[model samples]
Target: MDTVIAYLPSILRGTWITIAVALCSILLAVLLGLLGAWGKLAVSKVANIFADAYTTLIRGVPDLVLMLLLFYGGQQLLNDLGDYTGLWGYIEINHFTAGVFTIGFIYGAYMTETFRGAYLAIPSGQIEAGVACGMSPGLVFGRIIWPQLVRYALPSFGNNWLVLLKTTALVSVLGLHELVWESFTAGRSTRQLFSFFFVTLLIYLVLTAISDVGLRWLDRKYSVGVRRA
Candidate 1:
């Protein structure tokens, strides 16, 4: 509809915010995932227990519940602490920050399992051989571990990313003005709900299709020389 076209810019802007939030959230998730995997794999029993607990706790909760709890509860907690100590003024958590960290925190558990499985797939003998060849732990990780870890983990990682991308829509509930919110408002004003929402659906499909293509390319690049069964 013409009305949908007229509101295109606002929808696109919301799409961009959705993309930004997904990117930042994925980055944070990856960082936390790496730390969590390391903790799970570490020699220290306490580290292992802590990592296990984290993954368990996150898995037990719904993403929406966790997001709302963090956004509202975290904001309140921060202000309350600030009030009690008088160390700072009142604090507020913006929608973007809240969305990014909440999603990141939720997905990091899944990534932990992904990375852990990938790491487990690597033969320990290869690492022992690398050590035998006078390679340091860091060098062994960089040379022998990183590449295969990526190759093994990437498919699951890609799946997680797609899921995370769709999950960005959930942030609309927090008044983030993301794609869903923009489309909803546009449709309400124009009384052409299907038109605006259909456009939103197309944009999401395009994004997912593009991501799938790029991930496939990376898969091919990493799978080089491997004999496919």
Candidate 2:
């Protein structure tokens, strides 16, 4: 108990790092998803092909394999491109950057599908009605499409967020010093692996519990005119 108490600060710091990484990854995923959804829905064949390829390739690969490949292989590719183009010198990729980009890029595919489906679920007639009302395209989207898109997307978004939070543990493999890495180090040093891991497990449960509550609140907020069965 004393040892656990003593390591509390370290664990908290690691937890903070974990949260930071996860938030950044989610933001990136949302941005990519919006863009991918737009690309897929666009009239351009090139855009559709590109969006399809991106989603297919990302979804097909295992996350860990993609992470490792992106971290190591991407670094090599960047350096090679730099050397070839004479645009810059050899560049180093930090684990934090690598981790965030990898997780975000990987999950962006899932988000893309979520967003695309949500957008499609909106009735085209509503959009047409908005246009008939003399609403600009942007205004039409904001008033009609965006709200429903968010409502439809929230469930899948919440699920993706939960999974993304758990996936942050993988960053430890890159030596990012997040919760899992910190817990593993403390346990190894104290020779109390079970104790440390038990604490880690509890913290994760708390995080997910809090997330569930927050997500529910959002669901209620967005579901204001919606009637449930």
Candidate 3:
């Protein structure tokens, strides 16, 4: 108990880093997912092909391999380009930035499918009715499409978020001082591996439990006008 208390501050700091990484990554994933969904649904063949390739490629690759490649390979690629162009000096990629972007890029593929399905689930008649009623595209989307689309998307989105939150542990391999890394360090230092790991596990379970509650609240909020079949 004393050892656990002593290590608590470091673990809490690491947990904050983990939370920050997850939040930033989720936001980026959402943005990319929205764009990918739009591209897939667009009339242009080029757009559709690009979106398909992105989702297919990312989804097929192992996440750890993708993260390593994106972090190291991307850094090398950038340095090579800089050397060739002589436009800038060698650039160092921060671990946090690399981790967030890699996670976001990988999960964006899943989110793309989620958003696409949600959008497709929306009835065309609703859209047509909105247009006929002289509502602007933005107005229609905000008042009609967005709410229902979110209602349909919320479950998958919440699942992805929970998974992504756990995935932040992978960032520890890249030398990001997140929860797993901190816990491992504390356990090694104190020679109390079981204690520290158990504590870490409890923290994760608590975080996920809170997230589940919040997601349920959001689901109810979004489903206000939705008729359950």
> Per-residue lDDT tens digits of candidate 3, residues 1-229?
7898998999999999999999999999999998999999999999999999999999999888999999999999999999999999989999999999999999999899999999999999999999999999999989988888888889999999999999998999999999999999999989999998899899999999999999999999988876789
Worst-scoring 10-residue span by lDDT in model 1 = 1-10
Worst 10 residues of 3 by lDDT: 220-229
On TM-score, the candidate that comes out on top is 2
Runs in model 1 lying further than 4 Å from the true structure: none
The estimated TM-scores of all candidates read 0.97, 0.98, 0.97
Q: Give candidate 1's whole-model lDDT.
A: 0.95
Weakest 10 consecutive residues, lDDT, candidate 2? 1-10
Candidate 2: list runs displaced more than 4 Å.
none
lDDT for every model? 0.95, 0.94, 0.94
Judged by lDDT against the true structure, how good is candidate 2? 0.94
The alpha-carbon lDDT assigned to residue 21 of candidate 2 equals 94
